[model samples]
Target: MEVFSEYLIFSARYDVSMVTELDDSKPEIKAVTLDLWETLLLERDGANEQRNLIRCRNLARALSKFGVKISVDRLISVLKAMTPWLLTVWEKNREVTHLDQIRFIIKAATDGSVSLREEWLDELSSAYVSAIYELPPYLNPDAPQLLRWLKDHGKKIGLICNVGRTPGFILRRFLKDEGIGNFFDVMIFSDEAGIRKPHPEIFRMAARRLGVKPSEIIHVGDNLRSDVWGAKNAGFKAIHFSTRKGRDTIAESDPNSLISISRKLGGLKEEEIIPDRTITSLAMAIEGIEELER
Candidate 1:
């Protein structure tokens, strides 16, 4: 989750907003850009769970190539940081999975008493095993309700992720496992692209795949730099999903101040006919877009 706070400002804003619940009555998005990390599912802080888990898995796989052996506990430690957030995955599975179970798995895997087959040990050297075992899980169950809403509303959706180490394959697999794969018109992973957010090219690429000009699309993400700035630069409508409640107060404290803050944060200066509008929730975004047509 390195640089995650900066990456997920859009989600953070939405998290703060005490607005109408998520809805999709008059969806106008020719396409949608989703920021993977916090926007889709959040991993535990400090663990780099998603990436490290893949490294562990890959390292084990690579070691097997060299005839190295490994232990399950070691494999578990490598995968400890990864936890499945069923709520975020399944459209119908909104129930939260117990965190304790996740914790227990990690603790047990890291516990010193576990052992593995000698042949497995031979294939996986201690150095590789330790590195892999020390990695974490990609656990996040935020549910596919948002994705589902977009899909059901007849909008094309795509993923635009900014990740440090996690690969696009993992994200693809994760999304597919959550049953949201069918919703995306395209998926853009920074790792695979070699270019990250704030780069208009990435957003533009996704828009290209959807067969629409960026101007006709709406990008909903949790970042100011990558999501807001980049989307606007690419000529797409940008909406800030401020998730907080007191923002209305903040905005009201001095509408000018809010305007100033928004502009400085890569938002429109209240008077400027800018990238359409800003919203606090997916539900509001849907409504606002509809209102624009009215």
Candidate 2:
């Protein structure tokens, strides 16, 4: 009986060792894709609202210089009005350009009453973009380190981002200035791609751009629906960066914000949709991906 018990224990330990070896021998994941806001970039409580106000004031002042007078308060209203229209575009998996957004704001605010010359329009665009510099979102302290780790390990890195008031073009410049822009092999913005997350095509698009197969790529982001569901449905492995609460404002009253929040709030069973891995900090992403590969 003692000899039989010893044999059973030896076999069990040997099997576990073999399984671990086999798991480690699995093919390594080829690439990593990341979300922009709240993943790489950290948001402050009131930074966004303050930035929006600065934008409205900047544009209003620029208009005054061009001999077109519009109240800052009216500009604020026009800006808020864009939330619904912008949300509509996003819902359809389409994105509107920055220039179009600018045109919409001016047209909606003035009711076609004040048309600026082309040069004046150029000035207004600068005024709007400059607000970000004055009141900007800070980077995640873990971002640079993770990015470096991926590069060192020879993994192709890319960005799958959704832009709000700040457009893709501006974000590229911002990332470049932030000193980590060179890490990405490709960057796809919803605005430029004309598609949003939770839609599988966007993930596939990033894979194609990086010249990698979907199965060989892993994506990390904060939103479950947008990043996890989107990447997995599109055939890529995903890691849920649950450190950030979400991009939705807690008190947001915009119809779009409400609709987005409701989906998360409305879902009861948390496990109905699950990510391949969930990490509380970006630094753990390195080990998370390794585990996924295994």
The candidate that achieves the highest TM-score relative to the unseen native structure: 2
**Model 2, global lDDT:** 0.83
Report the number of the highest-lDDT candidate.
2
Q: lDDT tens digits, residues 1-294, model 2? A: 999999799887788678678876855689999999888998776676678889999998998897778898999888888877876676666778777888888889889986656887678888998887898889999999999999999999999997777888889999999998999999999889988787899999999999999989999988877788889899999999885354554325343442243235223356776999999999999999989876
Alpha-carbon TM-score of each model against the true structure: 0.51, 0.84
Instruction: Give lDDT per model, in order.
Output: 0.55, 0.83
lDDT (10s digit) by residue, model 1, range 1-294: 768877587677776344434342333457767776545554443344333455456555755565544454486453543333321221121222222222333344547343334454434333232332345334234336666666777778878876433446655776676667767889887656656666788888888888877867887665565577778898887766555433333344544331112223434343343445666555566665555434
**Candidate 1: misplaced stretches above 4 Å?**
1-28, 49-143, 244-284, 291-294
**Which 10 consecutive residues of model 1 have the lowest summed lDDT?**
87-96
lDDT of 1 at 137: 37
